[model samples]
Target: MGTAQAAQAAQTTQTAQTAQAAQTTQSAQAPQTANAADPGMEQAPIAYVGGMPPVMDHMIYSHALLDEFEARADGHGGQFRYDGQAWFGTDYDKLWLKSEGTVGTDGRFGDGDHEALYDHAISRYFDVQSGVRVDLDNGPTRAWGAVGVEGLALYFFQLEATTYFSDRGAAARLQGSYDLLLTNRLILQPQVEMNVYSTNDRARGNGRGLSDIDTGLRLRYEWHRKIAPYLGVTYTSSFDQAASMARTRGRQVHALTVTAGLRLWF
Candidate 1:
């Protein structure tokens, strides 16, 4: 009876040990099961250690345009005319050069206007410019201090308004243009310019008050974005005292001319 009781006690102890071992195994596997069900809890967040990349605003650039390089034929004779501009700088600031003039059939140049300006962007579509203007041609030469505003107006009209101060007198100019696209590669443009002066300058053929106005309509075909050929008609007229002065000199008060030209840009 005593041996039988001892054997039963040993078996009871073995059963208790097996149960403890099974409990320990379940505790170890519980955490691994939870991690497998929710893997995101074990992941580390990403960090940005490197700096940002560069931007293009700091770079410099340049552009040139020959807006008008045309030959004009009037009733009296034929003449050549040119207007061009170039600029160098960043997007916000630039140095600009502009020139325009007419060459007579006799090979004499007249009415040459040249300007060098500093331009600053004042708005998304506008700029404020201050500069010097020099009239250099076969006749008398004049210099002026110039200030102007140039921009795209309502509905994308290009506009410029400038005032000039000089020893001879004060002068003002207004210029505007609009492009009407007729097709993907064809465009029609209308342009106008007016000049006004405060004093008479017989040497330069300018008179007090409203001096002159020039208007043109042109049709251009763009074979490439940088090159276009155009045909146009231009009307120029003297006004107020300018007309009287021109008539006294036996010059025509007005002229209507046909033109052929090329427009180029780079």
Candidate 2:
């Protein structure tokens, strides 16, 4: 009987050791299984370092209306001219600069209108801008307050309209343009612009109401997206008192010009 009891106790001790070994192995694997099931180990979105936005969030663009390179008999005998605009910032906010005019053969630039403005987007496709305008020509060098809206219309048309108030008088301007693709690299563009005044500035040969209209059609082959050479025709006409005023100054009320120019951006 004594031998049998000793044998039974030995058997019980071996079974308990086996059970402990199994428990120990399971405990060793517990952390690894928990990590495999953890939600924190899943894929995550990219995190911006140093709490800063991406670099490509801002943009800059510019273009020039290199008009009048080849012009017909206009007001002043022979002149070189350029009209350009550039802006910098995000799509919703920007600083804008625009200038257009002519420099005579005598190496002087007098006929021009320029502005510097702050642009604020009021909608996805529209911005309201306010700034100052400076006019130079046969008239006095005048400075004016400018307010305007510029944006896209009808999904593609680019449009801008501005009103000006100055010590001399009030004025408004409208500019619009549309682009048509003739080929993958060839494009046709048409533009129209108008100027109106509340009062006539005889010194500047401007009418009290509708002063002038400028219309142009251009065809361009873009050698590259950043640069294009264009050839176009421009028609400028003066009306009412403005036309009579130009005649008095020995200038024609209408001028037709051929335009050749390069439009570039960086």
Q: What are the lDDT scores of the predictions, listed in order?
A: 0.93, 0.82
Residue-by-residue lDDT tens digits, candidate 1, 1-266: 69999999999999999999999999999999998889687777565457555567668999999999999998798889999999999888999898999998889999899999999999999999999999999988899999998899999999999999988779999999999999988999999999999999987789898899989999999999899999999999999788988899888789999999999999
Ten-residue stretch with the least lDDT total in model 2: 63-72
In model 1, where is the ten-residue run with the lowest total lDDT? 45-54
Task: Give the runs in model 2 whose Cα sits over 4 Å from its true position.
Answer: 1-45, 48-77, 137-139
lDDT of 2 by residue, 95-195 (tens): 88888887766677656898999999999889999999999765578899999999999958999999999878899999999889999889998999999
Q: In TM-score terms, which candidate is top?
A: 1
Error of 2 at 39 (Å): 13
Clashing pairs in model 1?
A: none
